[model samples]
Target: MPRSALPPLPPPAHLRPWLDDAVLRADRARFLTDLSRRSLGIGRLLLLWAVAAVFVLGWTFVGMAWMDVERHEFFSYVHGLIYTVLGVGVLIPAVFWLVRGIRQDRQVRQLLHAWVESDRDPAADARLRAPGLSLVWLLASFALGVLGLWVAFGAAASAGPSRTTSGELAYIMGTGQILWITGLLGLAKAVVHYRWAVRAFRSRN
Candidate 1:
């Protein structure tokens, strides 16, 4: 090939000045909007934020009861109940959602990969390959949840009317309650679990 026969670089298309500026502005705006979703994702890393409110409510009741300055006072006992309920209410669901949801999500992802039934079973669809939660795991959750509730009851009883209390204990009680409620959900699954457990007996019947 001769030097004079060399292909020249294609000139860039000339966009209208205002149109080019608009395109650039639009691109920048889109980039920012996309980043916003990722920025907001940081909060999801700490689901405890939702549980924080109940902690405050629980601590408040304990502090108020502690201020009553009475021994074996009925009012103080009732005051303790306020924190106890608030703690249990928040804890039960928070713990259930947080631990079980997170755990099941992880396990399913793992099982989805390891599932060999797809190869051997003709009926194995994508749904069958999908990982399912085990009753055993759910039972464990219920046990833990009940244990958490027990702790909350203890916290409530300890924050007596005569004792000086602070609002910070709400977090502890809230967490304890979370464990209990989540566990309850796990335990509640026992209805279905027992069905399978007694399947051998039911089959005979």
Candidate 2:
């Protein structure tokens, strides 16, 4: 096929990064290192969440230990209410994300579309990758928030006769509603991550 006979497609100058070749560069070490950096931001968010949850549980347990058994249940209700309010009653803890995801997810899908079929137009693909990257950031935020909430429950779950340290039982919403909700949020993030992966592949290629 003569170059002159072919129809002009999209330019390939700017869009190469988001495309597959740039991302999965044959240099395995660089590829893994790059991927780690890209994914680490989200991991830190999760770690922060874990740290915060620990503080909350610790404070609550210390306060409860000072009180008698009769007063313990009060803290239980109090703890429950705190998390419920924070999470908007647990049942629909991810309500905001559900709403946000619908729009964001659509944008991501559209991004995938443009990248995959843009006729090599790098600018259009670049625009799509922007939304995809933003979506990854959003997922990271959600994961961090949920991870922090779970840390408290995880701490409580580890509590035993030797570990309870007294007053700690009250902090153990073993069925830590908030932690479970947080897990759900992380699960949602996985879906978003998958979408970004798809979009990233197209942009790189």
Candidate 3:
């Protein structure tokens, strides 16, 4: 095909980083480094969730441990074994991730310093600008957040003041809290993306 016959490229402002080969190739190392930092952010979020899970599990065990023995000797032994195994399994990873996060934070800061000193490509920068998220996703995330809040609090309420710390009730409430918090984070990201998209659109118009 002749050069003139080739299709015209989209406007620079409209280019997407993930979709643009030129952007990816322009600074592959920086892109990958940035991606690592983003991954660390996700890891941090997971760490928070893990902490919450541990707290819930710890209290649930406190309630269930005695209940199990009272309910059935054989079943109590089995429950204790299961709890030990699960606790160890979750704890090991959570600790590892927590330690890793500290190292990752230091590395990210170094990388950020390097990135600041490095030269940048204007075209690539423009392409790296992410578009806004969909409205549907935003709404769905918000709904999930609402549902999570209701589930967490409702479970706690149902347990009554006398049994608020009961194992079964604690598990239900903790699960709900985690769900709502995750949903809330998602909703926040969606809103930010949507705002950015709107701003970009306005700039163009």
Candidate 4:
């Protein structure tokens, strides 16, 4: 059998010094590069993008509560409290992960830059480019946006304006809006990643 392409992962943490040595840093960067490739692989990335919809779902309830408050509806305060609780439950983790990802990306870039400059590792550059991942992101984002549009607008079109109750209409509208906006977010993410990948490829060449 052929040998594995990736470098072995760094040793157990207890073996490292107070600050990372060059070997440790390069090994860690290589490990993270491998992880990034796995996470951004087509099927896995698509699923990860789909999970982003939960953010829209949480915000939908918050919007519903806001509308209720604005209209002075009977359940305004109670629904607002309940919706706020539910939204917060979802949002806290969402925010946590968002912040974590940002920090991780920064650290990964810093380590990768140092490793590449010092070691002249070509595999790291290739992995960072992530050849097909950007195309997958673009395709997935487009598909998601199309689905969102159908969900958000199809309800009214099918039910007709006069047939649906206010609550029913609101529910459908909110769900649809969530899907549509989530798709937009996915598209934005795709664009950003694609641009970054393009730059990575150019830098490699």
Candidate 5:
């Protein structure tokens, strides 16, 4: 083909205007807003778990009180039934929601990566950093794990000598185990976030 008939070339880097600061700021803001909205769903799921845990504790206390006062056979059965139902009803849905949130978060991350790749602007890197767990959260998780283990072991040690009823002891142990598990999960999550943040910082450098 004749040179004059050839397609035009893309504008050179020096010839193109710099991406506007205002536009960049707007893009960053929009990205953060979307992320926050998505994260809110996860927060709600966690909140549900908290509420369910509170309910379980409350019922356990009531059941213990009933046992101490007068162990009615029918009431005992009813108490166990309610506890089982509430535990299953709440935990199952909470777990389901948690899994869904995780999947959604992964999808959002992929979308964010694609967005960054499309722009290829060094300035955008600052805005592209993934959210990580805070120091406060890490400390809280560790503390909770330790406290839970302490409670669980303490109850086990005292149960035999204190002559505590089997039902009450079981409840205490279960609560402690739940707390310990949750705390460990939190700690793991914090560690993952820390590692990811470190990798991102290194990549940026």
Candidate 6:
């Protein structure tokens, strides 16, 4: 009589680095705390950006209306248009990140629960430690940075002698500066994420 043996199961695809049971047991509390901090940080950042966007939008509209009424000029309309577009450009990504962060917070909580239930199984731990960066997010970050730069440059160029008045120069410069700073910040974030991704890949390989 002959007997057959079952084939070995494949490892989890999402398994990541730093999933050892000892590490998990030692750092579980800190890890959860860090997750909470990240969630709260993201929430605060989103709220701040949302408020800023609203303020900018309101200022653009009200200022444009006032300018049109007082000066009888179309330049205000153009300025409003540029500011609105840039504001929206930044707002959209901020919203996306906010939503994503909320979802990630939930996911991490579930993972924490699973890890506890599983007694910190290696596979579960690996799943929890899996890298979150994706091509879509990377591309979006890059696009946001580019858009910010483009808006900044456009704002600055629009303030040139032929198109704008002395009174408008300050507004244009302020808008450009805001956009440039935001763009640089976004780029820096992207770079940091990209480095993390590289490290994750290297570890996995």
TM per model?
0.32, 0.33, 0.49, 0.57, 0.61, 0.41
Tell me the tens digit of each residue's lDDT in model 2 across 1-205: 3421212232364875667763333332332223333332455345434643544454454444433343458776666555545433332423444454345444544443333443443443343333444456566656655665576567666878765654555544432544555555555545565566565665567
lDDT per residue as tens, model 6, 113-136:
433343333443343332343333
On TM-score, the stronger of 3 and 5 is 5
- In model 1, the worst 10-residue window by lDDT is 3-12
Go through the candidates in order and give each one's C-alpha lDDT.
0.44, 0.47, 0.53, 0.61, 0.56, 0.47
RMSD of each: 18.6, 12.9, 10.9, 7.6, 10.9, 13.3
Q: In model 2, which range of ten residues has the least summed lDDT? A: 2-11
- Best candidate according to lDDT: 4
Q: Where in model 5 is the C-alpha error above 4 Å?
A: 1-25, 32-72, 108-133
Q: How many residue pairs clash in each candidate?
A: 6, 10, 0, 0, 0, 0
Estimate candidate 6's RMSD in Å: 13.3
Window of ten residues with lowest summed lDDT in model 4? 1-10
Model 1, position 64, has a per-residue lDDT of 48
Clashing pairs in 1: 91-177, 91-178, 92-181, 142-183, 145-179, 145-180
Error of 2 at 111 (Å): 6.0
Residue-level lDDT of model 5, residues 1-205, one tens digit each, is: 2421212222244544666656654565556435533433346336534743664555465445545434557777677566566656665665676576467656654544444333345555544343432354467667877877887888898988348776667777767776776667666655654565466556556
For model 6, give the 10-residue run with minimal summed lDDT.
1-10
lDDT of 3 by residue, 1-205 (tens): 2421212222243454446565544554445345333423344445545664664465455445544644557978788667656656665665676566556555543443343233344443343233322344456557767877898888866777565545567567766776686567556655654564355445544
Ten contiguous residues with the weakest lDDT in model 3: 2-11
> Could you tell me the TM-score of candidate 3?
0.49
For model 5, name the residue pairs that clash.
none
Q: Sort all candidates by TM-score, best to worst.
A: 5, 4, 3, 6, 2, 1
- Top TM-score: which candidate number? 5
